[model samples]
Target: MPFASRRPRSYASPRALPSARARARHGRNGRSPVTGPDLPLAHTRLDAFEATVQATADYLQDLWPDELAALRIEVLPMPDQPPGVSGVARWRVIPQHRLVVLYRIPIERMSRLHREDDWHRRLMVESCVFRAVGELIGKDPWDLAPDRFRHW
Candidate 1:
């Protein structure tokens, strides 16, 4: 029989929805697609470094609770070098601003030597922050809290 309208008829099927794996792989409509277990996202260099600094600072605060209010940790893209030599980190011990600044680029360069292993990079950043903070506070990092860092 001839159809009255020119439009094609729609057909319903059993497989109306995408499979679970498909849905997981490609999110709803055009957002960032989610990778499967084979892949994972990593934090950017600056973010990871900042986190490392924060973690170390928290560790310090736990030991020296009274001193937490006096110290500040800062991260800068690059150090204020005399000319061509951008150093790893610096500290400025002012009245209200006892700041220990970590230079991102130099430290990233140091991290790259470890082939981008997150744990190694985190340790590197924390160590850098620890030494700088210790310098600003006039205490040896090993002596910051000897009992807390026996392995270190």
Candidate 2:
């Protein structure tokens, strides 16, 4: 009679819940639960800048594969050495190592843009990449992507 009078138990486990720190370490942390890491909406300015550099480099590489095949491109927050006679270098091209190091802060912050927008920012990044690659191969930046600019 006592067993029949008692209410049925709920399905969830009675174990103690995980600590906040443990949950945070194992869970999404701060990202939205519904979204994945590949979401384009999550891109930051740095991401966009790096992407622009990569796209420009890839395009140049496709055009001049022989020249760029062994070349390596890198992005740094800032240069390690002091500014040269000209000024803070946006990029450094070392042909001996086949490496091009781009100073992201100087390139992103120092450039004078007529219109402060995403398109102009991207163009600025691309120009830096093109110039760096041009220096690497002793070619002019305009010559790097000649056909792209040609309009009939």
Candidate 3:
């Protein structure tokens, strides 16, 4: 069959990229660029950080495996929080990938986990859950829990 003669002309074949433009930006391998906006934003206030953690717990509870439902999602406050740290946040992640810790660190510092950021080194409640959540939604944990769920 000829290209234009097909009944349903798809934008791109399964093996092809979304479009030439996207391919140009994403590179020949067709991977899209990841950025801050791509991250999930879960917002909350400083005083409400614990609540945010609970909500994430509930969210994870809904998705929990039979063996892990009782396995509580750990939540710790970042004392002396960095200047611009998200007011309130916690992490929830799909358990399979197990890269939550790896994902939490900025990409530039991924290779050097122990090398701490001057501002963040002290005031960061690091968790594997946040990292995994970041990986799942392609955004930082702070972005995912933008606020305590009104309904939760």
Candidate 4:
């Protein structure tokens, strides 16, 4: 008969299949299928360096509000031109502009850390920030945060 066939037709239709865009969009759920909330987001070296610099700057600012009130902190991949006289400058301070620019590449890569670890790397970044701020304000790096290292 005309209705009879070798194989039976499937109930599901082609339209039911998810589109490529829908699949890419995670099928209405915003989160990626591969990454869940339990898994933390990737943190790159640059991100860690910037975070350390910012935290150090904030601490220094709290200690010397009046001095750093008008100052601006910035992070750049590298210096635009070679420093006038230096063995790979880690940072530059411009008192006229009240700006401190930290060179991420030189500061992170050039330093010789006796023990290479996350803590040491963070300490290195903090050192650069403190030195840069000290240079801007005509003060020694150690003097910037005196009580911090003092033990009672």
What tens digits encode model 1's per-residue C-alpha lDDT throughout 1-152?
11111234355635556666666655655334377556875566666666677778888877877765666766667666566655544433443566666676777674555465777777777777677767777789888868865765
TM-score of 2: 0.73
Error of 4 at 130 (Å): 0.7
lDDT of 3 by residue, 11-101 (tens): 4757743776766664555554463657755553332333433444455445444433334333323223467876433333445533222
Model 1 ranges off by over 4 Å: 1-42, 84-96, 111-116
For candidate 4, give the lDDT of residue 99: 88
Cα TM-score per model: 0.61, 0.73, 0.24, 0.75
Clashing pairs in 1: none
Candidate 4: deviation at residue 21, Å?
A: 8.7
Single out the weakest 10-residue window by summed lDDT for candidate 4: 1-10
lDDT of 1: 0.64
Candidate 3 weakest lDDT stretch, 10 residues:
99-108
C-alpha-based local distance difference test score of model 3: 0.41
Ranking by lDDT: 4, 2, 1, 3
RMSD of each: 17.1, 16.8, 18.8, 17.6
